[model samples]
Target: MPKISPKLAICIVYVAAMMMDGLDATIVGPALLAIGGALGVSPAATNMVEVSFLVSFALVIPAAGWLADRFGTRRVFLGALAVFTLASGLCGAATTAGGLVAARVLQGLAGGMLAPVGMAMLFRSFPPEERLGVSRFLMLPTTLAPALGPILGGFLTDHLSWRWVFWINLPLGLATVLFGLLALPEHVEEDAGRFDLRGFALATPGLGLLMFALGEGAARGWGDPLVLGAGLLGACLLALLIPAELRSPAPMLDLRLLADAPFRSAALVAVLASGGLLGMLYVFPLMYQDALGATALDAGLTVFPESLGLMLATAAIGWSFPRLGARRVMALGLLGAAAAFVLMSRVAPGTSPWAVRALLLAVGFFLGHAVLAVQTVVFDTIADEAMGRASSLLSVLRQIGGAAGVAASAAVLAASGGAGLGAYQAALLASVAFLGGALLFALQIRPAPAPQLRAEAEPSV
Candidate 1:
C-alpha cells in the first residue's frame, strides 16, 4: 500500500481552511436580506453586520505576524478555527443585527490568522517545483466556496432560515480542527523580539480610517464631512506607517524587503490590478437586483458559473505555472480577464444573461493568480524569519485593494448621473481597462531560476 505524505495531509487541512474562508466571505451576501427581515432591521444595518467582518479581517491582518510569532502558525490556526466555529454558531442564535455583527467580528479575528499563516507554511515548506501543485490543490476550496455559498446560503435562507448560515460553520470547523490535530505538522518558532507598539498603532488607524471612510461613503455619501475627515486621517496614517516601519526595531511589515524588485513590483501591481476584479463583484449583484429586477435565486444562479470558471483557472495555472514561467502565465490570465470585463461593459436592457454568465466565467478563470502568484513572488524574495510579516502585508494589501476598487468604481458611476445602462456599461469598461493595465505590470515580474528556487521556502513562520 502507498503511504500518504505529510505534505498531502497538510494540503487537506489547507483546503478545508481556505474553503471556509471563501465561504465566510460570500455566505453573508445571500443571507443579508433574510437576516434583515429576521432581525427586523433595515437593509443597511444588516449590511454593516457583513461589513463588520471585512473591517475586522482587514484590521487584524497586520497583527497576524505578531500573534503568529508569539504562538506559532499551527497553534494559532487551530485556535482560530475553534474560535471561528464557536462564534459562527453563536451568530446563528442571535436575534438582533448587533448581536450578529459582534459575533462576526469574533469570527473575523479568528479567520485573519488562517490564510496568511497557511500561505506562510506552504511557502516555507514546499519545494519550488511543487508550489503550483500546492496552489492548485488549495485553490479548489476557494473556488467552490463562492459558487457554493450563494446556492447553499440562498437555499438555506429560503428554505431553512438565515441563521443556518452561521450554523453551517460549526460542523465544518470542527472537522477541520479535529482532522488537523492529527495531520498538521508543528514548527517551533522563536520568542518575540521587541514589540512594535508604534507600528501596530500606525497600521491599525491607517487601514481603519481608510476603510471607515469608504464604508461610510457607501451609505452616507462621500461629500459628508465625516468621510472627508476620515480619508484625510487615513492617508496621513499610512504616510506615517511607511517611515515608521523603516525605523522600527520590530517593524510589522519589513519595508526593507522592498529592495527586491520582483516582490515589490508584484505587491504594488496587486494593489492596482485587484481593484476592478472585486469592484465588479460588488457592483454586479446590485445591478441585477436594483436595476435589472432579478430575483435573488436568479442572480446567484447566473453568477455561479463565473465562480466555477475562476476555480478551474486556478487549478489549470497551478498545474501549468512551473512550465510556463510565472510572468507569461499571469499576464495571459490578466489579459483574458480584461477581455471579460470589456464584454461586460456592453450589457444593456434585455441583454442575454447567458452572455453575462459567459463573461463572468472568463473573468474568474484568469483571476486565480491574484493570490497564488503574488504570494509565490513574495515568498521567493523573503527569508523564513520574515515570513509571518510578509504574508500579513500581502493579505492586508489585497483587502485594501478590493475595498478601494469597489468604492472608486461606484463613485465614478454615481457622479455620472446614474444614466441608465450607460452608467453600468461605462463602469465595466473602466474595470477592463484597469485589468489590462495590471496585465502590463504583471509582465515585469521575474520568476526564480529553477536552480535558485528554495527547497523549503517559508518553513518556520
Candidate 2:
C-alpha cells in the first residue's frame, strides 16, 4: 500500500470538492417535478437549468487549464472553490426559476475547474505507482457522488425542503476551500506561453453553437432554420479549429498529443464510451421515475449502482495496471462494460428496477477502468512542458463526448417521437455499439513498461 502523504490530504480535499459539485448537479433531479408542480411549468423541459450548467462547463474547460498554467494552480483552484460555495448559497436561496438557473451557471463555471486542476496537482505530487493509487482513491468521489447525490438530495427535498439541496453544499464547500489553501502547493510559473486566441475563437463558438442547436432542436423542430444554421455553422467552425490547432504555436490545445497511438485510439474510445454512459445518466434517471412510477429517491438509487461498480473497478485497475499494462487492463474493462451493455439492451418496459440497477453497477466498473486508462495515457504521452494544455484538452474532449452522447440520444427520441422505455432502450443499444467500437480501440493500445517517475512531475508549462 502506498503511504498517505500531505499530497494525499489534498486529494481528499479534491474528493470533497468533487462531491460538492456532483451533489449540486443531481440534487435538483428529485426536485424538478416538484418545482414544475409549484411553478406550473412543464418539468420535462426543466432540464434547461441543468443543461446550462453543462454548457458553461463544456465551453470553459480548455480555458481553465490554460489559465492554471498562466496563473497559479493554487490560486485558481482556491478561488474556484470559494466561488462555487458562494454560488451554491445563491442557488439555494433562489425563489424564481431564472434566479436558480443563473446561480447554476455560476456554480458550473466554478465547478468546471475542480476535476482537471485537482488532477494537475495529484499527478505532479507523486510518482506513477503512487499516482495510480491516488487516481484509484480519487475514484471514490466519482462513484460515490452519484449515489450520495440522490440520497442527500432526496433527504433534503423530503424533509427540510428542496432548497436545502443546494444549501447543503455550503459548509462542505467552505471546508474544501480551506483544505485546498492549506494543502495544495503553489506552482507560480510566471511565463507559461502565448494564448491561442484564434484556436479559442474557433473551438468555443463551435462547441457552444453545436450544443445550442442540439438542445433547442427537440423543442423548435428539426425543420427550424435556426437549428440547421447553428448545427452547420458549428460543424464548419470546428473543422477550422482543428487545422488552426495544428498550425498554432502554444496552441490552446496541442494537436500533437493526438498523434500518439494509445492516446489517439483512447481519444476516440473515450468519446464513444463517455457519450454512451453520460447519456445514460440523463436518460435512466428520468425514465424510471417518470415512466415507471418510481419515486425520486428510487430513481436516483436505481442507476446509481454503477458508481459502486466504478469505484471497485477503478481500484482493481490501479492494482492490475502494473502487472497487466495499460492496454490489457483497458481491454478487460471494455469487455466487462460490453457485457453490461448487452444486458441493458434486453431490458423491457416492465423489467425489474433492481435488475436494472445490478446491470448498470456492473457496467460502471468496467467503464471506470476505461476512463482511468484514457486519462493515464493522455497524461503519459503528452510532452512534459504542455501538461496544463494537455489537461485542458482532455477535459474539453470528455465534455464534447458527453454532449454528443446526449444529443444522439435526443435524436433517438426524435425518430421514435416518444419518451417511453422504448426510446430509453434504443439509446442503450446505441451505447452498446459505441462500447463495441471502444473495445476494438482498447486492444490496439501497445503494451509497454510502466514509467518510473510520475507523468505529472515532468516539466509542465
Candidate 3:
C-alpha cells in the first residue's frame, strides 16, 4: 500500500471530526419523536434535548482556541474526542429525559472543541497558498453528513433502537483517537499566555445566553421575558467582550482578525451561508411532513438527493476554483443559491414533491460551490500563528448564524399562523432575502493574493 501523506492524514482527521459534529446535529432530529415516546415526555419538553446541546456547544466554542493555544492542538483534539465518546455512551444509556439532556450537554461541550481545533490543525499543517487541497477533505462532511443524518437516523430508529444513534459514535470516536495519536502533529504557540479570565467571563455566558434566547425565541414567544432579557443581556455582554479582548494583552477570540479585508468578507460569507443552509434544514423537514404530509422516513429520503447534488458541485469546484478564479465561482454560487430559494418560495401546497426535491437539489449544488470557494480562499490570508483563533471565530460565527437562521425562519413561520403551505413559503422567502444579502457579500470577496511561504517545522508521520 502507498504511504499516506502526513498532510492528507491530518486533513482526513479534520474531516472525521467535522463529520461527527454534523452527524450528531442532524441524526437527533429524526430520533426526537422516538426519544419523547420512550421517555414518556411531551414533545415540547423533549425538544430541550436539542436545545441543551446547542446552548452547551455555543458556550464552549470560544474557549476552544484558547485551550488549543494553552496546550497543543493534538492534546486538545484527543481530549475532545474522549469527552465526546464518553458522553455518547452516557447519552445512549440515559433512562430519563433530564438524564439524556445532561448527557447531550456534555456531548455538545466536547463537540464544541472538535471542529475548530481540527481546523486549526489542518490549516497549520498546510501552507496558506496550498490550502485549496483542504477542500477535498472538507466537502464530504460538509455536504453529506447532515444530508445523510436524517436518513441514517430514520433507518436506525425504524430498524433498531434510537439509542443506536449514540452508540454508533463509539467505534468512530475510538478509531479517530487511535489514528490521531499516530498521525496528528502537535502545534503549540510560542508565547502560550495566561487564561483570559475576564474575557472568558464576558464572552462565554454572553454567547450562551444569546444562543439560548435565539434558539428558544420562536418555540416560546419572542416577547417572553426570558427571551427578551436574555437577548438584551447577551447583547450587552458581547458588546462589552469586544473592547475587553482588544484591550487585553492576550485575547481568546482575537477580534482584531476582522480588521483584515479578506477575512472580514469571508466571515460575512460564512455567516450568511450558514444562516441560509441552516434555515433550509429547518424548513425542508416541515415542508415535506407538515405541508406535504409525508412520513418522517419519506421526508428524509426526499431530501437525500441534495447530497448527490452537493457532491457533484464540490467535485467540480476542485477543477473550477483554480481555473475560473474563486471570486467568480463564488458569485455564481450565491446567485444559484438565491435562485433555488426563489424557486422554493414559490412552491405551492399542491406542487409536485419531485419539483420541490429538484429545487432543493439545486440549492445543495449551488450552496456547495459557494461554501467550498470561500473556505478555500479564506485561509490564503491567514498566517499560521493566528489560524487557531481565526478558526474558532469562524466556527462561532457559523453557529450563531445557524441559530439565528433557525430563530428567524421559525418566527416567519409563526407569523404566518399556518394555513400549512403558506407558512413554509413565507419562511423560505425570508431565506431568499438572507441569500440575496449573502450574494452582496460574495461580490465583495476579492481574490486573496498568494501568500509567501516560510520554512519552519514540517511534520513527518
Model 1 error, position 4 (Å): 15
Could you tell me how far off, in angstroms, the CA of residue 58 lies in candidate 2 after the best superposition?
Answer: 3.4
Candidate ranking (TM-score, best to worst):
2, 3, 1
Q: Which stretches of candidate 3 lie over 4 Å from their true place?
A: 1-19, 31-55, 65-75, 89-102, 116-147, 161-163, 174-191, 318-324, 346-351, 379-385, 446-461
Global lDDT scores for all candidate models: 0.69, 0.70, 0.75
For residue 138, model 2's alpha carbon misses the true position, in angstroms, by 7.1
Candidate 2 TM-score versus the reference: 0.80
- Backbone N/Cα/C clashes per model: 5, 0, 0
TM-score for each of the candidates: 0.77, 0.80, 0.79
In terms of lDDT, model 2 sits at 0.70
- List all candidate RMSDs to the true structure: 5.4, 5.4, 5.6
For model 1, how does the per-residue alpha-carbon lDDT over 101-205 read when each residue is reduced to its tens digit?
A: 679878887887787777767776799888877775665466667668766776777678878878988888899898877777777468656677888788777
* Candidate 2 residue lDDT tens string, 222-243: 7799999998999899999888
User: Which is the better candidate, 1 or 2, if ranked by TM-score?
Assistant: 2
Reference-based TM-score, model 1: 0.77
